[model samples]
Every structure is written in C-alpha cells, then in structure tokens.
Target: MVDDNKFKALVNKYVELSDQIAEVGAELVALRKKKDAMGELVMQVMQQGDIQVLELTEQGGKLIRRESKRTEALKKEHILDELMLLTGNDATRAQASLEKIHNKRTLVVKDALSRKR
Candidate 1:
C-alpha cells in the first residue's frame, strides 16, 4: 500500500532541507564573525579607562558590560603528560580507555553524490 510517488517526493524534500540547513549554517558563521568584531571593539574601549560597569540605555532595556577571568584549558600534550604522570599509563592505553568512555552514536543521512571536494 506504499505510494511510490509520495516516497520519491519525500526523498527530494529531505535533500532540499539538508541544502537549506547548509545555507543557514554558513549564514550563522558569517553573522558570528561580525558579532565578534563588534565585541572586540567594545572590549578595547572598556579596558582603556573604565574599571567597572558601563550601562547603555536602549528603548526598553540596558546593555551591561563587565569583565571576568576565563579558565584556560591545558593542551592535549600537557594533559596527556599529566595523566601519564598520575596514572602511570602510556598514551596508547589512555587513549583507548578515553575512547571507550567518550564514544556515542548518531544517525546521518547524506544526499547521494552531495559530498565533493
């Protein structure tokens, strides 16, 4: 009782949606780049003289600005060195154990012949 025409239409729609997702993702990256540039300018202005908050009045709200320290993560080589020092395990064993704990699964559907260089 499956309608072949309907199934074909659904497949085509799925491919179209995947294409739309790629387009939107690209747009989001572009927007984030612009936002980061603006944020850097704001940060430089804040650091030059201001020591505390600067509130900007808007139509119905305010923009608060402040600074705080962000934690810096150790690099891969440093982390592995520490792990080996603490656990007495070599790189290969540590990686295998981490892989077992970190593995997860997701289902992916790709358009036929869509991936290319």
Candidate 2:
C-alpha cells in the first residue's frame, strides 16, 4: 500500500513537471520569435546609423556588430550529385554508394514520453 502511494506520487510529480516544461517551452518559442524580429530591426538601425558598437552606460555592456560564417548541412541531393560525379555520372552506382554509407552509419534508440491531447 505504501509503495503504491509512493509510485502514484512520483508519477503525479512527473506529470506536473512535464506540464510546466511544456508551458515554458511555448513561451520560449514566442519570446525567440519576438527577439529575432527585434534583432533584425536593431541590425537595420545599426546599419543606417553606421554604428558597429553601442555602449549601454547604465547596463555596463556594449552590443557589437559582427559577421559570422555558417556552414549548411549536407543534403541527399548534394550527396547524390557528388557521388554521381565521382562515379562518372552513373546514377545506380551513386545510389548504391549512398545506400552503403547509410547502412554503415550507427543508429540509436531511446525512450521518451509523448504527451496526449
């Protein structure tokens, strides 16, 4: 009887925490959208004003404008194109190579909770 009560309590706590996390997750997504929009606006302002750095005297901080490089993830089409090129434009060979690579890659599985509506 005691064990059953304890198990029920743990499950209840887990459900409550999961609910709180989901709510916060939603708020974070909304906040990120707003922040991204504001960031674009700030970038435009900085560009127009020809300002690279803005100092906040009260906040004891400064915002610095900088450029960053981002690399795009490799897609299947890109891989296929490259493989076909390497294989003398042989589609079948390229596909076989792609399949071989995919087969050799490791796969992992883990348990997760799915929220019910």
How close to the true structure is residue 81 of candidate 1, measured as C-alpha lDDT? 66
* TM-score per candidate: 0.55, 0.87
Worst 10 residues of 2 by lDDT: 108-117
The models' CA-based lDDT, in order, is: 0.71, 0.92
Model 1 over residues 9-108: C-alpha lDDT tens digits? 9878878888898999999999999999998887778778673466555655544565579988745566566666666777777666555544543658
lDDT for model 2, on a 0 to 1 scale?
0.92
lDDT tens digits by residue: candidate 2, 2-116? 6988999988998899999999999999999999999999999999999999998999999899989999987888999999999999999999999998788789999997768
Q: What's model 1's TM-score?
A: 0.55
After superposition, the stretches of candidate 1 with alpha carbons farther than 4 Å from their true spots are 66-76, 83-117
What's the CA RMSD for each of the models? Answer: 5.4, 2.0
